[model samples]
Target: MRLESVVPLIPAELVAALDHSCGIRTDTDLLFFGSSLDIIKKLPLGTVTLSDLEKFTELVAEQASVPGHRGDEILAGSRRISEKHSQASCGVKELDDLVGGFGDSRVFEISGAKGSGKTALALQIVIQGLLADADSCALWIDTSGDFSAEKTAQLVRHFDLAVSDKLLERLQVSLGFNIEAVHDVLDALRNSLSSSRTVGPAVQWIVIDSITPLLLPSLSAVSSQGHAMMTTFMRRLRELAQTFGITIMVINGTSAAAPFNQSSAFASTNRKPALGPSFTFMTDCTLWLSKTKDMPDSEGPFSVHVAEVFRSRATRSRIWCTFQIRHGVLSSTIPDL
Candidate 1:
């Protein structure tokens, strides 16, 4: 409270003297910070009686505020938990444990050389997620137009027709040859999901298999527009994911040389992830997949594969797990200690 606010309680003769000469304008100023004796000394010795100062002090003391909590104390009281409330497995237990599993409202990137099984890994996770939660569905965006239905069916061939058919039915696949194509697909998909009367299971996951083609053409040494477009594209994807609680996974194939974004293409052998370092922080986590040595005591088709956590906010970077693809299924393998 200001000195004027307590005017009725304060003596009329003392108002101007205490307010101006004392410099105690606010209720806080009138508190003990400025000693009562100091205030009395500042006032006219004859005009203000000690009894009058005591009365004024009592009135202002009623309006003084208590101290508040410090920033560190408040932060300590509200410490955060990093674990996600809901997690969708990657179908391999060891692999799932390696990177904290896929969770809602986060973007994940899988980058690797061609034939390293990036697409296969993404598809398996989606299928497993759908099976794990019956109410969940997924959107598969095939950017290169070569997404194989036959291969996808092969993985679910062992299951009964009813289960397999329904899972595949719930999965909606679309071709997106360019950035515009994928953006349109995502926009329409988001709109359809917003309706309360949606036709089927709610979409809970999205896989953009190989984002190279969609973004490669827009990049060059002199142009920054491509990067801007990429940022916007990712922003929209994140918005959709957060709004609907969808988990987004993007496949980023590698390039042979550091500056060979144009030379590199999806489904081809390359040395590094295409596009450039811009992808380092675009996603919540980055998993690098690559084919390793063949499994011993088995047929040649099943080779040991490695999935490394190149970057993550929830898991330690550079940590990796090994698995094998046997009979169209992913199985976790423990390496000798």
Candidate 2:
């Protein structure tokens, strides 16, 4: 049946004629009260009721579809713009040099032993993106509950951001203790990005404080079901990153055994890939942060070796760069090498 026949079936309250006096396209499908075209097209001809229309409108409004844009094409265009932006920006020189700036639909895994400044780097990205005036927002998925409001405030104060209040409001931190909670938060975040214009740009970065927590439990479980669950979760994360043009940075904790060398620091050891090669393979870039004991005592000062991009697969794999966190700002010593 034609939409015209269905028009009479629609309640008088829900059906309103378009004001074509303004010269807008009236020949198209009828616009619902909620302004969703999807509902108009999907509404059945004879049996559809006002309540059905309302429900359809609500469903579409809640989970709107992403505009169809080619991911590779978008990334290519964004790369040129990001390179220019990175050249002007400070602190991110080493990182920008390596990857030419983080690309949309990319998953970067930062893995190393604990206290490797993974969280610090993630925070830096949030601030730098804001500084670049990209109208971007970050989603901090804190699995470890280690994200500090105080730290964020310090960074805000250090930068003296003119839009401190606005930027702070834009950066959303969701604390999820369990895997289920994490999944739920991720879903809610995606839905918010799809539905709310007020949330600014679709979440530019999704930083999961640690992906290992979810992985380790799944890997250790007694049944094959556990492995399936793990695979499903990782696939979902990849899908989310690709669908929304968002960059996902997941911090992973490395085992005591060295990732590359099998030789144990102690006597007896069972060596394996620090974190499974599966994670390394899944990620677009695998960065390692480690202290450089080789630096002279006078040059390095304390043993705190700052942040280092140890392993980046994009441009060069075995490049090492040093960085310092001063006044809550990450300053890299290495130039674009």
RMSD of each: 19.2, 12.3
TM-score, cand. 2: 0.64
lDDT of each: 0.73, 0.59
Per-residue lDDT tens digits for candidate 1, residues 232-321, read 577667667766778899999776753333322223324667778777688888888878776555453676777878788778887777
Model 2, residue pairs in steric clash: none
Best by lDDT: 1
Error of 1 at 303 (Å): 0.7
The Cα error of candidate 2 at residue 89, in Å, is 6.7
Instruction: Report the CA-based lDDT of candidate 2 relative to the real structure.
Output: 0.59
Question: For every model shown, what is its TM-score relative to the native structure?
Answer: 0.69, 0.64
